[model samples]
Target chain A: MSNLFANQAPLLRTKTAPAAAALIASAGIIYGLVLCCINSLETFAVSFLAVLLAAILALWTFVRMAVKENDRGLLVTGAACMTAIIIVTVMPEGLPASFHVYRSFVAAALIIGLCVATLCSAVYRLLGSTPVAFDNSRYPILILPIVIALISYGMILFVLCLNGLPQISWQLISTPYDPANAALRGILNDILGTFMLMLLTSIISLPVGVGAGIYMSEYGGRIAGIIRFSTMLLRAMPVVVLGLAAYGVARMAYDTAWQGILAPDPTIMIGRGTFLLASAFLSLLVIPVITRATEEGLRSLPRDLREGSLAVGATEGYTLLHVLLPWSLPNILTGLLLGCAEVAGNVTVIVLLCGFGNYGVTPFTEATSLAHFIYKVMFADRSFRMSMGNYVYAVSVILLIITLGLTIVYLVLRNKFAERYRAH
Target chain B: MPATVEIKHLSVSYNGTNVVKDVSFEMPAGKVTAIIGPSGCGKTTLLRSINRLSELTKNCRVQGEIMVDGENVLKMDTVLLRRKVGMVFQQPNPFPKSIKENVLYGIKAAKIKTDHSDIVKSSLQKAVLWEELEHRLNESALNLSIGQQQRLCVARSLAITPEVILMDEPASALDPVSTLKLEESIQSMKGDVTLVIVTHNMQQAKRVADYTAFIYRGELIECNETEKIFANPDRSETRDYLEGKFS
Candidate 1:
C-alpha cells in the first residue's frame, strides 16, 4: 500500500511519472487508431505517423518499467500489440486490394484492445491497494455508460456543425425556395411555415390539454378515467394514422357543401394539403404530451396546498385556478415547451399532407416545414442530395437549435420556479 | 362575533367502519377549546366535520348535526360553511403567492367587494405577524420561516372574517420557539373568533385552552374547564389518557 498522505491526496495528482506517460500513450494510440479507420488515404498517412509516435512512447516506458522493476505484463502486451498493428498496416500492399480494406479493421481492433489494457494497468497503479482500487473504480465504471452516450450526441452535433455551418447564409434564410434557380433556392418559406404551424398547434392544443389535465387530477371520476384512457390511446397511436384521418376529413370537407361555403377557390384552402390541416394533426400529436405532463405536475403538489385553499372557502374551481394551477405552473410550461419542440420537429403528418414548396405562406396555404424539407430533399432524389445535401444539414441544425432552445428555456424556468416556491 | 359549536350524536365512518362513533360536545363562543386524544382517535375527524372538510375524503360518511351559532353544518353549503369556519393544518401551508395575495385569496374567490388594503393589514395584525412581515407583503409567503408561514396561514383564514377557526395539530410540526409563538397567536385571537385546536400534546392543551375535551377510541370521554380536566376528570378513561397510560 502507498503511504497514508499519498492516499489522502487525489489519485491523479499522486500518479508517478511512468503512470502518467502510460496514460498519455494509451490515449494517443486510441485516437490514432480511430483516425486510421476514417477510410481516407490522405488521413491514413497522418494517422500512421501518430501511431508511430505513440508506439515510440510506449516502448520507452517499457524500458523504464523494466529498469524500475515495476508492473511489466501490460507493457509487454502493449508492445506486442503495437508490433502486430504496424506489421498488418505495412503489409496491406502485399495482399489483394480487397484484403487491404480489412487490414485497417484488424489493426484498429488490436490497438483498441492494447490501449484499454494499458489504461487499466496505469489507473490501477495510480489507485494503489486492492480495496482502494475497487472502491475508486466504481466511479468510472458507473459513469462510463453516460459518458459514452454524451460522446455519441456530441459527435452528432460536431458532424452537423462541420457539414452545415458554411452552407448557412442570409440568402438561404431569407429567399423563397426555387428548385431550378440555385441562387433563388432557400428555406425561408419553410422556416416561416414551421413557425406558423408551431403557433397554431400550440393554440389548438394548450387549452384542451390543460383542461383535460385539470379534470383528471382535480375532478377525477368515471369521465376522467375515460378522458385519461383516450389520451393514452391517442399517445400510443401512430402519427401516420392521424395523418390519414386528417386527409380523409379534409377530403370529405372538400367534397361536401362546407367547401362551397368556405372555399370558392379550392387552391386557397381545399387542396389535398394545407397548413391548417397539418397543424390540427400535429396538435393531436402534441396534446397527449402536454396533458400527461400537466397531470403529473398537478398530482405531485402537496395536498395541503389544495386543502388549505379550499379550507379558506375557495370553491374547487377557484382553488384549482388560484393555488393548484399556479403552484404547478412550472410543470405545465415544461410540458408545453416539450410539446412545442415535438411540433417543430415532426415531419410525418406534414409529409402525408403535402409535397410542400409550391404554395404561399399562410395558415390555409400548402406550406412545408424544416423537418419535411430535410426529409424530402434528402430522400426524394439522389441527384438533389449530392448537390444540396448541405442545405438539408443546415435545416437539421436549425431545427435542432429551435428544439434545444425551447428545452433550455423550460429548464431555466423550472429552476427559477423551483427555487422561488420550494414546494413543501 | 364568535359563534358557539354544538355537536350532537356525531359519528364519522370511512369505508363502512366508524372512526368517530356517537360523539357529542359543545365548544363555547369566544373561547379557546382544545381536544386531546391519541392518534386516530377522531380528534381530526371531528374537527373537519365542523367545516365539512372530512367529506372530501373518499368513502367517508358523516351523520348527525353540527350547529354553528344556530344553523346545522351538515346541510349548509360547503362554500358558505367553510368561509364561516376556517382551518389551519399541522404543517404551515402558505399559498405560493405574495403575502397580500394569499390573505386576499378567499375574499377574491368569494368576490367580496371590500377595501383590500385594510383587510390585509388587520388580518396580519390579528395573527401577530404584521410587524415582522408588513414590509414584505409583496414577497412570496413561502419565503417565510415555518413558524411565520403558520402565522401567515392564520392571517389568510382571518382575512375572510370567519366566525370559527379549527386548527388540526397546528403546532405539531413547529420548533419549540415557533410552537410558543403559535400558542401566543391562538391566545391573542380569543374573544373575537372561536378557536378549536386538536392536539396530542397535553401541555399545549393545558396552556392554550380555556376548555379541554378528552376523546378516546372515537368517543368523547370528557369535556370541562381546562383546569378541572387536568385536576379532576369525570371519566377514568380520561384520567388514564391524561396520565399517559396510552398515547
Candidate 2:
C-alpha cells in the first residue's frame, strides 16, 4: 500500500494538479458570476454549463494520463473526485439559510485565493521560475487594489443614480423653494447663486492667481519662494477657518464690532453672507489651485521654446506674452475649471455664514449653493426632511452634474491643446 | 551686411569654476567659421559669448570683451544684441505657430514694421525652404520634418536680417539625410550672413567652413584655413583629435 501511494504522487503532480487548479478556478469564476445577480435562471444555466465544461476537460485529461501510465492510483484519485462531485450535487443543504450567506462568502474568498496561487504556480513552471516569472506573478496582486477601488466607486455612482435619477424634473429645476407653498419649490435661486458665486470668485482670483504663478515660475527669487510657501500654508488651512477669517475681515471693513459679526444690525450694512463676501473667501481657496496650475504649465514648457523665443530677440516679458503664456493657456484654463469645481461643491463657508438664501441672485445678496441647499434641507426639520427627502438627492444629482461637467470640459480642452501643440 | 566678431581675452566661469579661460579669436565677415573640439571643451560657450547668450546661465560670470561692429557685446543691451546676432540651436525650436508667423516672430516682436509677406518670402527663399513650403506657409511649423523645422528656424533668424548667425551643432540631432539638407541650407546662406558654427564632426567642418579654430581644455589651440587645420595642424592636440587618437 505504501508503494502504491508513493507511485501515485508523481501521477498526481503531473495530471491531477492541473485538473484540480482548473476546477477551482472555474468554480471561483462561476461563484462570483452568480453572486452578482442571484435568482437569475440564465446565470444559473451559464454557471452549470461552465462547471460541466471543466468536468469534461478534467475527465479527458485523466483518461489520457491513465491510459499512458496504467497506474491504479490514478483510478483511485479519479474515483475520489467523482464521489466528491456527486455528494456536493445531491446534498446541497449543508447549512441553514442564516449560515448560508456568510458561509458562501468565506468559501468564495478562499476559492479566489486558491485560483491566484494556482495561476502563479503555473506561470512559474512555464517560465522556469525565473525572476521575470516572479515579476509576472506579482501583477495580479498589484491589480487587486485598483480593481477594489474601481468597484467601490462604480457601486457608489450606481447607488446615487438609482436613488437620485427619478427625483429630478424640469419643475424641480426652474422654480424657487417656498415653505409656504409647495408648487413653487425648486432650486433656481440656489443654482443662480452658485453660478454668480463661481463667476465672482473667478473674477477675483484668476488675475491674482495667474499673475502670482507667472511671477514665481518666470522670475524665480526669494520673494517667489516666500509667496509659494504662503500659498501652501493657506491651502493647508481648513475651509471652515477661512470662513471665520472672512467674517472677521468683513466686520473690520464694515466698522462693526467683532461681537456684532454674527447678528449685525440692518444699519451696519456689512452684507454678511453675501455672494461678494463668500466669493472673496472662496478666492482664497481658488487662487492656490490656479497658481499651482499656472506654475506647472509654465514649467512643463520645453526649454527650447523659451530659449528660442529669447534667442530671436524677444525679451523675457515678450517671450512670456507670446510663447510661454499662449503655450500654457490650456493649463491655466484647466486650473480655472478645477477651481470652479472646488467652489461649486464647497458648503463649509456658506453654512457658517448663513443657513439658507431665498433671495434673488446678486453679488450683494445672501449666497447659497446647491450643496448648501442640500445641507439646509437635510438638517432643517425632521418633518420637512420626511416630506421632501428625495429632493436632497435630486439637488445632489445636480451638484454632481455641475462638478462633473466642469471636469469633463477641462479634460476635453486639455486633450485638444495637447493635440494642437504636441512637441515634435 | 555681415560683420566680424572679435573676442579679446575672454574668460567665462559658472559658480566659480572656469569653463572658457582667456580664449581670443576673430571670425571674419562674410565667411563660415567652424569651432571644433571634443565634448565639454567650451566650444559652445565660445560661440554663445559672441551673442551674449551665455548670460542666460545662472551664476555665470564673464571677464572679457566681445566686439562686433565696433561695439562691446558684453555691455550691449541683450534684447538689441540678440536681435543683431541670431542663433540656431542643436534641436529645431520653432514656435507653435504658422510657418509665416514663425518666420516673422522676431520682426514683429521688435516692432519693425515692414511688408510682412515680402520679408517672409525672402527669408524662406534665403533658407532654401521657399520652394517646398511656399504653399503651406500657414501650416503649423511643428508639422514639418525635423530637417524642415531647422531650416524654418534659419528662415526665422534670417527674417530679422541679422549680421551674424550662430549655430551650435545644428545637425547633431538630425539624421544623415536631414543633416545633408541642413548643410545645403547653410551653404545657401553663405556670404549673405557671417556664420559661426560649433561642431564636433571634423568632416562637417571640412565641408562648410572657410576657417576652422580648434580648442581644447577651454583654450584656443589652433586657428587657420580649413584645409591647413585638417592637413597640418599647428597644435599636437588638434593633430591627435584629427587623426582619431583621442576624442
Badly placed stretches (over 4 Å) of model 1 are A1-136, A178-183, A255-271, A379-390, A420-424
lDDT (tens digit, per residue) of candidate 2 on A161-266? 8888898889878887666676777778888888888899999999999999999998899999998998999899988898777666655545445323333334
- Candidate number with greatest DockQ: 2
Residue A129 of model 1, lDDT score: 30
> Candidate 1 at B67: error in angstroms?
1.3
lDDT of candidate model 2 versus the reference: 0.77
lDDT of 2 at A293: 93
Q: Give one digit per residue, the lDDT tens place, for model 1 in B23-71.
A: 8899999999999999988899999989998988999999988999999
